[model samples]
Every structure is written in C-alpha cells, then in structure tokens.
Target: MAELPIEIALDDERATQRLGQDLALALRPGDCLALRGDLGAGKSTLARALIRCIAADPGLEVPSPTFTLVQSYDLRIPIAHFDLYRIADPDELVELGLDEALGDGAVLIEWPEHAGDALPSGRILIEIDEGPEDSRKVRLNGPDQAMQRIRRSLAIRAFLGAAGHDDADRQFLQGDASTRTYEAVTTAGGERLILMDAPKRLIGPVLRDGKRYAQIAHVAEDIRPFVAIGSFLRDNGFRAPEILARDLDTGFLLLEDLGRGGILDDQGLPVTARWEAAIDCLVALHRTDVPRHITIQDGTAHTIPPFDREAMLIEVDLYLSWYLPHKLGAEPSPRLREKFHAGWNGLIDRLENASKSLVLRDFHSPNILWQADRAGIERIGLIDFQDAMIGPAAYDVASLVQDARVAVEPVLRDRLVARYEHARRRDPDFDPVPFREALAIMECQRATKILGIFVRLKKRDGKPGYLRHLPRIEAYLRRTLAHPVLHPLHDCYTEAGITPSES
Candidate 1:
C-alpha cells in the first residue's frame, strides 16, 4: 500500500535539524533518503544534523559534499552523503558507488533530480519548501514500511517536546530480543536519561487457549507494567529507574539514567564484589513481604502474574520445538514430545509448594547495574523487571548464578548461591533443602529454554550473535541435569539429541 505524504512545519533551523535527528532514528541500513529542495532550503543542514546525531557527537564536522560528490561516515550505522548536482551523466551515479553505499549503510542524496532514473524506487522522498517569515514546510513520502518508521519517529519527537525535552539529543543505546528500543537522551541541561520507545507488543498467531506467546508468558504488552512495577520497586527501596515523564498510551518513557556500571568488570568477567552485592540485594527483596497487587503513585493498579505451570511448560517446549529440530534435523516423535512435557510437568508441580516472592524473571548480569557509590541493596540497580511475577524466588537466584550472557565460574556461582542461601536462612520459614532442589530445577528450566531461544534468535530473528553463547548454556544445562531431581527429564533430552554432554 502506498503511504500518504506526511507534512511538517519547521518554524526554525532547530526544527529543521530536529527533523534530521528524527530521520537518524528512523533510517537503517539499505535505506536511501532523497532530499528535494531548491538552493538554501536547509537540506545540507538537515543532513549534517543526521550525520552528527548518528555519530553521537554533537561537534562532528560534516562538510557539504558539493565538491567531493560523496562523503562517507564510519559511524554507528555508516552513512554516505551525496551531492548529485555535479553529475554530468546518469551513469556517474554507479561510478560513485551508490549501490555499495546502500549495501553497507544508508545514503542521503541532495539534488537527487540530477541523478535522473538512477535512484532506487524504494527510497524515501523528502521535499522542503521555504514558507513566509523564516519558516519551512517539509513533506515526506516513502514505502509503507518506511512511512511507519517515519511516523513513529515523529511521534517520539512530539512526545519528547511535550515532556520538555524538545532540545534533547538522542543516541541509540541498545535493543534487546524484544521489539522495544532504548535511547540515551541528553537534555539541554546535560542530564542523561533513558528514552524507552516500546510500542504496543506485537501479537503472534494464537498458539494456545486463544493467547499469544507473550500473553501466556505474562510478558508486558505496554509500558504500564513497567511504570507500575518500577514505581513499586522504588517505593520499596530499590534503584529501578525513576519515571521522569511518560505517555503511557504511546509507550514513550523518559526514565532516570541508572549509569553504566554493571556487575561485570572491564574484561566481561564477573566482579566478585558486585556479584556479592547483587546477592544481598535479592536477599533483601526476598525477605520483604511484597504484595502481588500493587498500586502505583498514579493510582494505576497492576496484579503481578504467576509464573504458572502452563508458562514454564511452554517455555521448556522451546527446546523441543526449536532446539531439537535444529540439533537433530527433524521434529521429535509425538511420543518423545509427550515424555518431555511429562518430565517438566512433574518438576513444575513441585514449585507449587516452593518459597514464593517477586521473581524478576531476568535477574541476571545484563539487567543488574552496580552502583558503586550507593549503600547496601540500593547499590544494585534493577533496570529490567517489567515482567516481574509472583513465583519461586529460587528462579531469580538461578538466573543470576547461571548468568546467561556472561559465564560465571563454578566457584563464583557456588559462592554466590551460598551467600544468598545464608542470607535467606535468617527467614524463619526458609527451608534450605527444598530451596536447593528448586534452584537446580529452575536452572535446568531456564537453561533448557535458553538453548532453544538462542537457536530461535538465529533462525527466526537473523541474530547469530546469541548463538556464540550456546556452548556456555549447554555447559550450564549439563551441570544442572546432573541433579537427581532432574534425572527423569535427562533421558528425555538425551533422546532428543540436545542433552548437553558431560564433557
């Protein structure tokens, strides 16, 4: 479907540059933007702003390519700025490496009309016209997909302006396995905040019980869960990022910057002191009698979902669904699949009587920030707990000790677990043996799920980076399966050809 042209009024040069910044956030590799305007129409100014924003350096030198014809930047996403005004023939576009430029990164072409029919039809067309009294009107039209991205970027810019961050600069921070994206916004006052740009969650094909995978897993569908849970954590004395500004319906949030300190050292190895502190943080949290139903300061209510049998079972099924086929080159037989579920069903049943607390489903190194200057449990910054559930506290402990992204050594892992166990022992109701069994069970469950997830990330999402950690997860899974309680499922995994080798 063709997208209608979107028009914006730029009242000043800053607004023109802000459009460039929005374009920076919207465009990706293989994108080409053709700027259409007469001389002195601010095309070069917009291009410069985009290049500098992508470079994450406000002072970057972006000389016009009028004479050079093309100037390339090796920034986060490499970009090529082109001036087609000097082109004597249409064939000159090929010689200038337009295809090569679009191959590795994006392109911005000024005087695109001079290139004749050389431009790709998929390119985004932006036209700028001077208006009365130092104003300009810009119209942008592109492919439906590109238009969607452009619209989202414009919405985010408008949201930021409404939140009083109109002059803030945005730099891409990172993206996770989910659809959400994060940006580091530097306000005009030099304060850095995280701009969480999570649109409404995508609903996959209904898999079971008329629910999608996210719904079954209790994954948050919007920013409301994040706001409610973050507020709850802060009220209970944790360092979750404070919500500075929010547009809940739009899923745009300006959150307090929790700093870049993490539990890992410079070499990506676990820092013992930080790990110990994280254990203490979890200990304190587990000790607290947290209610499942929490009302935020805004009077919004959220009920923490239970990490129930169906959720855990479906999560483990990822191993059979993705990993088994990827490993064995075929689907498991119906008999073997049923056996896999039967084993996990029993394990999940045991959790019904296990110790319950708020489970930060992803309580690992990636989500944990080490705030060196803060005191006690507050030093551990809890940044990613929107999917918090009321479930066995042992699940979170297992997630931390068997850190998914970073390989925590055996000695360190045992020490951290022991520290947590020792601290939890202070609770009169804490039973050490049952907790140890639950930890082993949770370890097997998480590792099994991740084994499939890593492969799925490569096969489904085109992300091969996570596959490198497959061996690490296998090692963790192998260690966990050795526990006597997991023996029933060990054979099921072995038959499926994903049973981690003892070696």
Candidate 2:
C-alpha cells in the first residue's frame, strides 16, 4: 500500500495560477474551489482564469459580483463565482442565492465568507498567496479520501489519449453545517458517501478501539450492544449504506452517498408522498428482531450515565433553559425547577422501562431519506444514532410522528404510529388511549432534549439558526403535554416558566 507523494514546492505565481487554470479544465459537476487570500492577493485572478477555461466562452468576462453578490455562467460546465467581500453576514448568502450554486456545478468564488455555514464538505479549499514579484503560491485541500481513484483517473487519462468526460471542470456540493469538508471522489460512478464530524471530542477514543465507528470496517464486539439494531436493519431487506472505507485513527468515514435528492424536508414533493415512504421505513425498523444480546454492562452509552440518565437530564435542562426562558422571558424559581426535573425524570423512567428495544435516538425526518417513487423509503438511513441504546420501541416512532423541524399531519402521524405498533406485535393488547399517552410522553422527552441541543448548537457549537426550530419543537412539546397522560408533566413544565408555546 503506497501513499501518493504530495509535492511541496515554492512555485512562481505565474506557474501556480497557470496550474489552477489547468485544474479548472479538470472540473466537472460537483466540484468546488474555495479561494483563500487577503485583498488583492490573486484569489480573483485564479478564479477568473478557471472560469474562462471552464465556460469555453472566451466571451465570458469575469466581473467581480461585489454588489450583485454571485454571478452564474453557463460554461463548458456550469460555473458560479461568488464574492463575499461586501456580505458581512452568512444569512445574506441565502438571500444572494449562493445556496443554489454549491451543488449544481463548478463554483469559483472570489470571497466565500458569504457562503457562511452552507459550504459543502466536498469543496476544495484553495489557498492562494502572493509569492515573490509575479508569482503566487497555490495549495489544494480535499475532504474526500482524495482516493488514488481520482488521481489515478487523471493518470490513466494521461497515459491513454481517450476522453469521455473532461476532468477540467467540476461542480461542488455544500451543506448547511460547518463540518469543514471537501471531497475528491466522483459519485457519477454510483458510489455512496457520507461525511460525519466527531459530534464531541469524547468520540476520539472510541473510534480507535476497533468498533464500527463509521470510520472503519472494524467492529467492536465490546460495543456490540450499540450495533445490534444497525446490524439487524442491514440483515433485513432494509439497506444501510455499507461502510466503504474508514481511517479509525482519524475518525473519518467514507460512506455510500444516498444522493443529494434524499429528502428530510424538501418542499418540492407532496407530504403524502414523502411520509408514505417514511412510514414504511419506520415499520421496517420497528419490525426487525431486536437483539437480546444487548449488554447494559460496564462502559456503554446506555449504562444510565451521560448517554442515559445524565444525558437525558441534560436534555430536560434544555427545556428548562431555552424554551422556557424564551417563552417565559426568565427562568422559573428553584422550586418550580425541581418540579420539572422530578416529572421529567419520572417520564424517562416510564419510557426507559417500557419494552426496551433498539432505539435509534434521532430517527426522524432529517435523518430519513425518500429513496423511491412510492410508499416506504427505498433505503432508511440512521444518522445521529451514535447515542443509540436498547430502549423503548416507540422512541423512534415518537420522533417521526412529532417532528419539530416541520409539520407532520395528524392523519399521517396516527397512521404511522399504528403501523409501527402493528409491526412490533400483531395484537399485543392494543390500547389507543395508552398508546397516545405513551406517544405524548415520548414527544415531550424528545422536545426537552432538543431544546438543550438547539441551545447547545447556538451557545456552544456557534450555530444560531438551529434556534429557529426551538419554537416549533416547543409547540410539539405543548401538544404532547396537552394529552391526558402527560397533563401532570405538562403542568410541571408550565410551572417551570415553560410558556404555553404553540405555533
């Protein structure tokens, strides 16, 4: 196994810019170049040349879209060049329409500051610097494995004079998260890929010990409890994009890309069409034979510590801190706070003890993908499952039914919950009354946790937009609280300064 040698050299500015221009010809759909440099540092010069080479329209003039923001051109490949010098805010990027450019084609930008949080992980971060006299120094950083597959493609095309696709021009994809990404592999050949960041620094150690930590094919029998459900889902007719490549040392995983079109909340499609697939996927997950091999033994996410009791308490705290404060404009008194905690703790115990199964903690709309044209997901994806534990079967069901990011029709929710229960047991003493009660409990459990997570995203992760979903999640919590089963807990939340949030 030989690693490709990276050449480090101080090339003249002219040569470096020329090399960039040449690289432009290699661009194709799904490629991005982040031009990094100070003012008048030649970032624009290289971007301009790359655009010209890509558009093949010598008439295509490169104008800095300082005021207009982003200039899109129909080139040999679609090219979007954005200038963010004037844009002080990332939200402005959405208004300027750079969101549409990140994934469609090759994007060359003079200033990417406007891209803000929406930059794709598949972007190439190009650092351009002013070198001596007329020279510049250029660097290329990639997010994809930078597989020899890509470098090899270049080498083979060079070795044999055959050309089907031009590598000179490329397109790029960016998401709304600050995952800091760039990819080198081409998905046109039908490869699936997913990029995940270590959500917390606590994950670094686990990735090294040889568990299926997304970064490696390595499996941890010690951590087998965490994977039983995932392995079960894969064994069933359901498909989880198999782990393709991993570097456990770095905690980086290369997954099968489910495609950009996978829907969490794409509004272009009808709700009936989307949830129809979602419901089926949930059914499959719930129907699977839950592994009894789960060990609540020492050093697991489920031993009732940070990932469970303490972690769950942390979630309840989110509700106490943000949603309640935002709606009430202040924190409740200590007595009221204790009441909320006691009620919340009781709720956790009820769910944690009620029929333990593999609970995909974050199984919801954003984590789901509509892979087919009809009912049921062509492939159900499980993200944010690192916090998984053998717990209530209704945990994920409550997640899908009471999604906070968007509205889920009550009709759909009712039908889906019924489906999940049916799949779990043909007639395990069906009780709609208690079921609804359980659902409300679960939804509150989720909302309480998300309130904390969203606040954490803003307070700690530097992502403020997540706060937007707070009100909606608060509304979901309210609905669940209104149920007769959850009335006591709901009262506790209200007493704790959680305003009656419904929207």
Best by the lDDT measure: 1
Q: What tens digits encode model 2's per-residue C-alpha lDDT throughout 253-343? A: 3445565445444564326655656666765655556554544223333231122555456556766666566556777678778877888
Candidate 2: regions farther than 4 A off: 1-200, 203-232, 262-270, 292-307, 373-384, 422-434, 495-503
Give the lowest summed-lDDT range of ten residues in model 2.
Answer: 212-221
Global local distance difference test of model 2: 0.57
Global lDDT scores for all candidate models: 0.89, 0.57
Using all chains and alpha carbons, the TM-scores for the candidates as numbered come to 0.96, 0.60
Clashes of 2: 38
RMSD of each: 1.8, 10.9
Candidate 1's displacement at residue 269, Å, is: 1.2
Clashing pairs in 1: none
Q: Which candidate leads the pack in TM-score?
A: 1
Candidate 1 local lDDT, 1-503, one digit each (tens): 67799999999998888889999999889999999999999999999999988998879999999999999999889999999988899899999999999999999999999988999999999999988866899999989999999999989888889989898888888889888899999889999999999999865779988899888988899888898888778888998998888988888999999999898889999989999999999898888777778776557788889999888987888898898888889998998888888899989888888999999899998899888889998999998988899889899999999989999878898899999888888799899999999999999999989988889889998788998998788889877887888888877777754464444
